[model samples]
Target: MTASGRSAALYRTVWRWHFWAGLIVAPFLLVLATTGAIYLFNDELNDAVYPELRFVPPAARTVPVSRMIGAALTAHPGAVSRVDLPAAPDRPAVVFVAPAGGGEPLRVSVDPGSGRVLGSLVYARTLVAWAEELHGSLMIGTVGDRIVELAACWTLVLLVTGAILWCPRGRWRAAGVLWPRLTGTGRRFWRELHGPVGLWTGALIGFLILTGLPWAGVSGDLLQRGSAALGVGYPASFRTHAAPESLPMKTALGTAPWTLEAAPMPRSHAGHAGHEAPLPTDDAGAIAGVDRVTALLAAEGMTGGYRLFLPGDATGVYTAYTYPDRPEGQRTIYVDRYRFARIGPEVRFADYGWVGRATELGVQIHMGNYFGRANQLLMLVPCVGIWLLVVSGVAMWWKRRPRGRVGAPPPISGTRFAGLVAALAVAGAVLPLFGASLLVLGAADLLAGMWRGRVGDAAASGIG
Candidate 1:
């Protein structure tokens, strides 16, 4: 084939792969983008939704953490329960203690002043949970999760390839190529749908795709390697050898370089048989429950603002992660339900693994939480842009289908093929999902060429 012919063939090959991948994943991608957009304002939205549950103050002579625990156990006798402490200063202190074997946790909002159970409710209105499920896995569990991960990582290849196709080689109309000049209905509609939208939303969607892949189990390893290359220290060592006592929650909280921080309360992981007291074994009133924790925080004057995570299993410690400012500046503290003493090592945002830190910062950026509302509002432009890219991509594919009985053209020249191969290789190194996809694309292309070659041979034989 001639040089120009080869270039066009190469472009078609890439376009084919990009087209198929986008079509298969477009619906899921849209779901992810939409849910993600909603999640971006979770802080503001959640507050507005449940102001009553969140807006409690520290009253004088608040009940003790120990007393609160006793009260929760009394409320739900013979239940294996945990408590989630409110991290924010404005939010009320809630205890979540569920019964063993069945039923939901008893969620009670305590007055903290008299250990009075102010109101009881379930942990419902879980929009964030729903958003997370849709965004992460499309509500399809592991397989769905893997597909999303692969799609996000491969999207970079699609973006790069699409841009190449969009740039007309010699017949480049500057305005048409770069900016959409809406002269007629066709131009105006196409420009509105594709031209301007792609330009504006590219970076935002790119950020989302890049940051999101790391959370996928498939690309997690590649993300870590990339993070290490960027001079950020990803966690190289697991804390298996370190004793639970060695890592106190107070020490972790102190790592945050914040002005005001709370001290962790007395707490312990159940069945961790190492240092202190025997695990509490009373039928109804053995361990200090959630109410006691709220009161203790108030009594100790640790009430600038705080959050509490209820212990999950029998062995988990009730963790308290505190944030004074909305964006930066956070501290973490833990308390043992059984002992009512502090547990685990203290750590800060910066102290987390490199991937963890990046994910945190990325989340902050995604939410417009880092700077303020102004920054958040500015991000809406990019979000809309991303939606446009997905939509236009589908339209372009639909418009390009063959009219007659013509099959796909032959494979491109080796040189152009080599360029695509190289691109895929580099992308794979940064994200394993992309790396794996390159292999899949190559195999698919080779098979297609083989099938076409055989058809040509049969046709030639018939003519002879």
Candidate 2:
């Protein structure tokens, strides 16, 4: 085969994969991009949507954190999981309450200045919450998580193939390569539009995808374990203060720093190292006072919007962490519920090590939380660019596809099957979910091709 033949084969092979991968990834990417873009301003959006619950008048003297907790508990009797502190004078404090027995947590808004309960809403019921859930897992729990991960893994393949298909080939002409030409119509127009948008947005979108992978269920877990194996993953937070059977912090709190999610929940064990007493009962009144925890945190120079997770039972520790706009301010510290002693090593942004630190940095930037409004706007470019690619990709296929059949590009025989297999093999090895799906896709493609061949033979013989 000559150079033209190889080039044609490469184009045909990449185009086929680009088609399949896009089809698989398009819907998920749309949901991710839209929800993710909106969530970039989650704080702003929530405040705008529920000003009454989130806002309070500024006062010269404000009530204590304990008083705010007292107000929240008085309004709704339950165990306080955590409290979201006010970022500014006007923003109200939010106490998250897990109902008696077991249920979803409730967000009880309180005016810090007056120590009055403002309003209550289900934490899981808010708009941004729904958007977040859908973006993460399509609101269907574990199955949805797996699906989303699979979609994300395949998206990488889509990007790789798209890059090959859109790369500047032969002589670079500004008309279709550098920018879209407005003079074309139909498939020509879409082709011109798709290439330029993809070429410009590919790297950004790829960065987002790679960064966001750490949040995925399967790939994220592998990456976490891989990093740990390489001595760059696990951190000091993994050291348990007490029982090995104790719940993981992530399970107990529903969220933690990505690096510390699997760390054992710290307990307040008061003993001389060797001997430890039996765990105490779960009683709300028995735990340390919120004022003491708040005062201690203040003394430690914690001056931002921190989520103070109040202890539930005797063995529990008060977990305080800040969800700051930037990664540098990240901190997760625990205090003994009864003794009020600091428990375990405090996990900070610096303790994340190299890989963990890098992951967190990427995650912050991905969410547009690294640099405030400017970061949000910068991230929006890729989201808009993704939507543009989706539109142009579909348009291109629609204009050129045959009406009767699914318009997947035809396989070029005597061409690059080995190369295609090699690419898929490499992709699968890297992404387990994508690799598993590749087998299914290959089998399906084989069957479909055979079916098409039989139908063609039947037509040739004039047999239905």
Candidate maximizing TM-score: 2
What TM-score would every model get versus the actual structure?
0.74, 0.90
Model 1 lDDT on a 0 to 1 scale: 0.58
Regions more than 4 Å wrong, model 2: 99-104, 240-244, 270-282, 286-288, 417-420, 446-464
Flag clash pairs in model 2.
Answer: none
List candidate 1 stretches off by more than 4 Å. Answer: 1-10, 47-51, 56-62, 65-84, 87-89, 99-101, 104-125, 171-175, 186-188, 221-305, 309-318, 323-328, 334-345, 353-356, 400-415
Report the C-alpha lDDT of model 1 over 1-464, residue by residue, as the tens digit.
79888877877887666666667667767777788778777777767876665567765555565565566556654343334445544455565655544565456666555665555555533687677678778788998888888778767766676666665677666675576665645334554457556665677778877656656766754454455445453232223215344333334322222111112223344565343322223433334465555555556555535555554344545555565434345555556767766554444566655555656677566656677777577566666666777777665554554676223333444545777667677877767666777788779878988888899999989953
In Å, residue 46's CA in model 1 sits off its true spot by: 3.5
lDDT score, candidate 2, position 134 = 94
lDDT (CA) for every model shown?
0.58, 0.79
Backbone clashes for every candidate come to 30, 0
lDDT of 2 by residue, 410-432 (tens): 78866756766887798788888
| Reference-based TM-score, model 1 | 0.74
